[model samples]
Target: MRTHNQRDAPGLRDSPSEVNGKGTSGPEPNKRRGIRGKIINALSPISVGKAKIKHKKKNEEREESKPITVDQIRELIHEKKLFEAGQHLLMMEKASYAEQSKEGKGAARSEIEAAYGLLKQEALRVIKTSVRMAPVNPELLQNTVRAIAEQVKEDKTAALEKANVLSVRPRLWKEAWKEMIQESVTERMQVPPFDGVEGLSATAHSFLHMGKAMKDDLITVVQHIKPHYPNDFRVCCVYAECYYQCFSSQLEGIAQFELGSGDNALLLTWVQNIYPNEIKKHRVLEKELEEANLGTLLPLKQIKHLEETYLINELESLKRCLARCLQMEVTRWTQGREPEKLDGHFHSELSIDAIQAVYGGQKRAKDITPDLGKQIAPLLLVELLTFLQSYKKELERFLKDNKQRQHFEATVIANINNCLSFRTHTEENTMPGQNAVKHQISVVLHEIQNAGFEVLLQGLFQELQALFKKFTQKTWLSCSSIMNEIIGCASNHMATLRTLKEPFRQAIVEKIHLHLVREHIARLVKKKVSLRSAEQQGQLSQVIQTNAATLHAFCTENGSNARWLEPVLPRLAEIIRLQHTDAIMVEVGGLASQYPDISKKHLAAILYFKGNLSTSETRGILSVLDIHLSATLPPTSLFSDIKLS
Candidate 1:
């Protein structure tokens, strides 16, 4: 064993050769140990642990100091800008884009550059902010993203307002809708990659509530604004649209109460008032007004009142107006005549106009009574017509008395007829050997037809033969008498036609006017009854709908005079229908007790059916019989199966 000093092992720093077994100290000992030993010692577990700790600390520091890769920076920037980094990635990673990138090769390389540039700017900003703040808080990032979204929305709204495209209210409505879309877009952007699909789908449901609010506001505005501008066409259109919306909003309101309000009285009156003013007082508006059937809005009681009042007014007006017009016209006519003012030569010639004037007023006065000729005295219209006929006859007699003029006119007519009857042969038909007779009958017939003497021409050939026979019998008497008789017959026929002209024309015109008046009143009554009868009993309502129209028509015509004639037509129709039904019923059974009235139709029907007449034959008999109905029958079958009754 070595001494204590040897045991102490020479101090490494003090001596180089103090130790015997350990060899050298300090640098020489460390060198003699060999690099492998040192290296092995350095790699021992304890040393390795200390070195690993130090190396880890150094690596963390280096990572913190190095610049972030462009991709990571871009990701951060995208998250801050759009608030939807993953969604953006997904959009960029579309299958189409990916395929294009794979297949297009270098062609789409510029798009990639653009994408990188965009990402780079975004990432740079995010990074710069993150650095300034030292660390990025998640809440701050979210708030930043929301603020950006708000700014984008504001920008879009500003742009729309700047455009000044639509009217203010409509534009506002559109902007509201656009804001909703922007919100949805912003929501979708906010969704993370994992939550994106569900978030988008959920956001769509918000639009339903939004849509309802929009419609409600629009309707409220229209309703509020409409009444202020009643005559404005635009306002009217809007009001109508809004009303339609309200109507559609509630189905029950549309169906029950609204529709049953029946005619739109106010609208009808407005149209009636305004249309005439706009169309320049056209006479055709009268017909249009009638067709529009504004009276359809009136109740039955109102219609009856209108009919009575209007009938009185129209008759009163016509009477006064006609009398005044006739007096004026006659005065004008009388002005043309002058008197010689000599004793006997001052004979007054009765003028038709003077007669018409005197008689017209009388006719109106006569109409005020029940009896036509006796009680009412003669109507001026009747007297005027009678006077005209008598005057024509007197004129004819005077013409005949003046034989020279009469004979001249007669001779002219006869010579014209004779010349027309004398047919000449054309050169083509006048060959030497051809002896054909020319037919002059057609030429004579044409001349007579042209003269408006068709009745005289009807017995053309026979009359001509008679004339020829008369010419041969007795020269003096035959020529004068036969010729005079022919002329007299023609003159008498012409005189009759002329005298009856005014009466016939007046009768027809009055009849037509009455018919139109009756038809209009009938329609008015039908409309009035229809409105009331909608809620009435079915059978009674149907009767009103069906026969009331026809009955009302007659009531409208002739007023009190028609009261007698009015009931006759319906009674007749009822009698006919019951008669036909009873007749057909006879084949199976007896007539129903419902129809109890006796009439010509009933009797005829009983006779025909008992005799077993065919349907066609029965109809023919009824038509010829001209039977009127007096009552109606029940719904009991006339045939066994009722036969589509």
Candidate 2:
């Protein structure tokens, strides 16, 4: 029935007689003599030492009775009570260190150290379990990995080894890498005036550094993750960038060492290695863009802008790389030569075969065959054409709807602006050896004029040719209607292409006129005509007149060069005149035959007065018919005998 404190420390309960007079529990002072007590206290140090030893032993026993467990440490870790867990582990290690300092306590220290190690192991297991629970969370993975890294940082070799193993897990590694990239971008964004190559390079360097630090780790992670996101453009771009950093570093070093040394074999090797996949990526991006459906809840303008922006960035990156390659070649070729002498010296070095090789031979060998360094120009032209062609059908479809057309036009304008801005940026940022690169870009632009016009003409010609062929076989009314439709379609296309430049506008109009309208008219003239009755003849006459008049009006309204239609107009007019004259003669004959008493004078007057007949020609016809004319009756009454009325 002892109190808890007394039971815990029985010496205090049994020492009442030895307590101090002030009621503190302690050994009682001896009453033999005051001087004797002082001498005894001063002489005995062993008793005080024994009391301290006893107190330390009791504290140790109390600690051992309620020892910390690995499971408790793990629970704290699971609760994310990391600071508390660390404190507990630190306390345990400190206790072990203290115990090792004690005499005859080597085995106790070993036991404490083993417990601490087990606790650390449990903490790590808990972290792994948490990560597995939320593997896809980038922030969580990043934080957990960071914590693990910090925890093992004192043993850097072991920490890096563990990090390597952890980063190889596909889900964990991707989230960690993406988080790193996003953090880098955020950091770069914090700086001011961030809008050019410097900003771009800063951001790119983050990825480059990470790739350098974790080369195999990054590659392993990417290879494992790519299958799940095949068409993810961002992932594709990042992957390309990693490859670029890995491969370009070696190439860059080689170029720097070989600069102005007249050795381009190294640069060419780099080009051959890098260009194939880069060009292949372009084709892949083009295919993806072509297959993308713009029909969604998202605004068409935004969708188009994003798609175009992605493509522009990719193309610009390729262009920049190509420019760098060209620059290196220029520098290499111009070594030991005066700046003036370097002019046109590197032209022949730029070959389509090299470029075609870069595209993995996807382009026809014939198409890419170089023309005195013009091969790169046309190769790039083909790329631009492919981009435009992919969107052509969709654009046409867009034009069919008013709202879509407005959105499409806006997108086109935005794309053009972006192109201009890119060109200006390239020009402004020209490096030392980029003159040749600029020349190549200019050549590509020039080639686009011709190539784009050809594509435009080819498309319009095919369409109009079919329409013209259809017009030639149909009835005149149907033919006229088809012609009008063709004209309208051509007009719309011309208007659209006019956004490009004068060459495109002029070429489209000229081609449509020459191939469709002019051909249709020429073929119409060669058609056979067979009139079986007067009514049929009249109908034929009317159809011819209406078709001719319609064609004339269309040409006039459309600003067509009228000289081309000169040969066909007069023939059509003459046919109408002759049909009218024939009708007039037939009517005159019928009237004369009905009135048997009709006089020759009346007949001559009637014939001369007919609307379609010329006066002199009418008189000649009267003489040929053996009819006589007399001055006889009054001029106004001369036709009185021609009718009974």
**For this target, which candidate reaches the highest TM-score against the unseen true structure?**
2
lDDT of 2 at 560: 49
Q: Estimate each model's TM-score.
A: 0.16, 0.22
Q: Which digits, one per residue and each the tens of the lDDT, describe model 2 over residues 1-645?
A: 888876767542434455444445455553222466668676667788899999999999999789786567667666655545655655654565555557866665555456445544443443333312333544433344444333443244434556433221221333444444444333322334435555444333333333333333323334433333324324435544444444444444443432321123213322332233323224443332223311221233533333333334334544554555445533433243322212222122323322433343223222322221233333444443343333333333333343322233323322222233334434653445557666655555444334444545665667776766664333643456776776776666655454543333444344454455345444444333333344544454555566556655654455445344333333433333353555545444443343333455544432322335456656554543353323222212212312321
Candidate 2, position 29, lDDT: 55
Error of 1 at 439 (Å): 45
Error (Å) of candidate 2 at residue 5 is 99
Cα miss at 373, model 1 (Å)?
30
Report the number of clashing residue pairs per model.
8, 2
Compose the digit string of candidate 1's lDDT tens values, residues 590-641: 2222223323344352333123345665565445334333335422222121
In candidate 2, position 582 carries an lDDT of 54
After TM-score superposition, what is the CA distance of residue 503 in candidate 1 from its true location, in Å?
Answer: 13
